[model samples]
Target: MTTAVAATATAARQGPRPRGLIWTVLRVHRPALLVWCAYVLLMVGWMLWVQHVSGARIRAELDACRRRPEGACIDVMTFSHSMNEGWIGTFIAYSSYGIAAWAGAALVGRELERGTAQLAWTQSVTPTRWLTVKLAVPAVALTAGTTVLVLVYRWFWSADEVLRGDEWYYTDPFLNRGPAILAYALCALAVGALAGLALRRSLPALAVAFGFVLWFHLYLDDHWSELWPMRTITGTVSGHDLDALPASHFWPLHLMTTGVVLTVAVAATGAAYWLLRRRTR
Candidate 1:
């Protein structure tokens, strides 16, 4: 018998077996998976293109002006900084908002609203397993994609010190520079699940999830500087330098905030599980 015929015959003889809960969740959310893949591909591709083109521009400008750019070289350098660091960093920082919205509206809320989740529960899949898969699959996808972007951003950022607009201390760049962004994203997912389970409707869940995250991020932004003890310069430093945070504190501040965010993520996830169990019980 041919290989194809043998396989078909084997399958027919074995009969159909039940698909795993994870596989079922993935199949149901295939569109979302595709969208995430596209988003990561497009974002990574764009950042690479920007790095290449901007590297060329910076080199050209450096050569033309002998490294001390006087006129047009400054503009090119500035624009390159905006593209390479400003735009890319901003996207990396704020992309969690989109994740939050989609998690609430598409992943959980709509499934519940349309009785899709309920239908799944009848198929020997416990509600707990269903909810666990729903959160786990997206969390893994988000972490993987976000890790790629963070690595590329760091690679691109290292080559981009000369073109200066965004700095490591800036909110958007700072978040992109560390695990804080990833923590924020996971927290967003958890919060979104909680919102969906609470509202049981797509649009309202989407709005509440997005708004809560927006406020949460803004709060972090305003308070992140206080997460760690700031060192003061007793020496004679001029104007803005007086208020400027010591560069050495970058890691301390970053890690402290990352811990805070991750703590919140864990708490939110706990809340989600608690809520799911309560309602289903």
Candidate 2:
């Protein structure tokens, strides 16, 4: 009897198994977690390899060309530029679009379509908490992953100007050079969650979310320069003469756009919550 009483006391102190909603969300979406990790690592590793390996090769060829004044150095430089600006840029753009689709279909819509979200709600978790966990986990993960990629990209972008000679106004360089990428990732997540909640169907939500993100990206690409007024330099500049902002003005424009995108994300998240609450009521 004394042993039984002691066991009961211990059980009371230990409490029930700690199966948190956040943990449940994570457990359910572990495959996506792996994918996100792989993508971040791949991009970071590629940039590092380019910066230390391919970039070094290009530099060596340039030095050799300077000494000899003849060789395939121009070809080397051209290849390096294409790899850096063309391939990497395209990968980043597609990855951003993929995030929106994944969030809409795999993260939220599938669960709702399968009635798993309803099952979760019936079990002691509130609808608000359910949706919160859904949004919060992906938001945190996306932000961290995108921020790491941005930092690595920036390092490679500025490391060797001769090898990866990409202009600031280029689509890839412009987007990956600052915190704007993270903002876009978060916006995509929010937009995906909203679409999934509204549609409650995986395929439709995926299509709509991707389309919205694509449109937003295209809009920004066309009008990003107009976000901040360009400063004209009348004097002779070393590069081509064009009406554009100075290099120093890049971050200001990016930050302003980031702010706008993040605001839209917040609004989308708020709307999702309101709609969920109303549906549950």
lDDT by residue (tens digit), candidate 2, 1-281: 99999999999999886369988878988999999999889888887777777777777777778877555345756485656756876687557688889989988899999999999889999999999888888888888888888888888787777666678878788888788888888889988998999999999999999999999988988888888888865556776566867888788888887887788889988999998999998
Model 1 residue pairs with clashes:
none
Query: What value does the lDDT take at residue 1 in candidate 2?
Result: 100
Error of 2 at 186 (Å): 0.6
Alpha-carbon error at 258 in model 1, in Å? 1.2
Reference-based TM-score, model 1:
0.88
Residue 36's C-alpha lDDT in candidate 1?
83
Local accuracy of candidate 1 as per-residue lDDT tens digits, 1-281: 69999999999999987469877778888898898889888878887877788667776767778756456445666575576667777778998899889989988999999998888878888889988889998999999998988888778777666675677788987888778889999989988988899899999999999999999999999999998877665555554335468778788998998998888888878888888889888
Alpha carbon deviation, residue 107, candidate 1 (Å) = 0.8
Summing lDDT over every window of 10 consecutive residues in candidate 2, give the lowest-scoring window. Answer: 69-78
